[model samples]
Target: MENHFMKRSFLTLPLVIALTTSAAISQSLPPDDHQNVASLQSAADQGNSDAQLKLGIMYFNGQEVPQNEAKAAEWFQKSADQGDENAQKALKALFR
Candidate 1:
């Protein structure tokens, strides 16, 4: 049980960091997803799972971008494919 708890914490740590980073950077992000989001876009395009997850949330919530379920799924799928635990959870939640 202790080991399981540790593993769960490890898995969730990235998610916590991603969410915190997203919130920290949100104010500086472009108001439009299509516009410049160089740091995030660069990392995501390079297949960074965390950035992919962030993009998924932005699209899903219309945080800084227009709400588009399709785009959200697309980003989440990309991260999930990379074995990001948070992204996998996000994809599941997005579908349901």
Candidate 2:
């Protein structure tokens, strides 16, 4: 049970950080997902799992964009395909 909890904590830590950091950033910006969204999409299209993971979070939390779990799952899938552990964990949670 302890080990399971540890694993859960490890898995969720990235998302927590992503949310917190995104919130901090959002408080200062126009909150338009366009620029970053385009950049993130470009990176994802170029096979950058890090960008894909970040984009997924942005969509999931509606931080910089409207909430869209399906789009979030799609981006997470792309990142997970590149062996991004955080993306894989997020995809698992979204699917569940």
Best by the TM-score measure: 2
- lDDT per model, in order? 0.75, 0.77
* Candidate number with greatest lDDT: 2
Q: What is the TM-score of each candidate against the true structure?
A: 0.61, 0.64
Off by over 4 Å in 1: 1-36
Measured with C-alpha atoms, the lDDT of residue 32 in candidate 2 is 73
lDDT (tens digit, per residue) of candidate 1 on 60-90: 7677779887987899899999998877876
lDDT of 2 by residue, 1-96 (tens): 999888888776766675567556756677575356778788888999888877887888886689998898898899899898878777765544
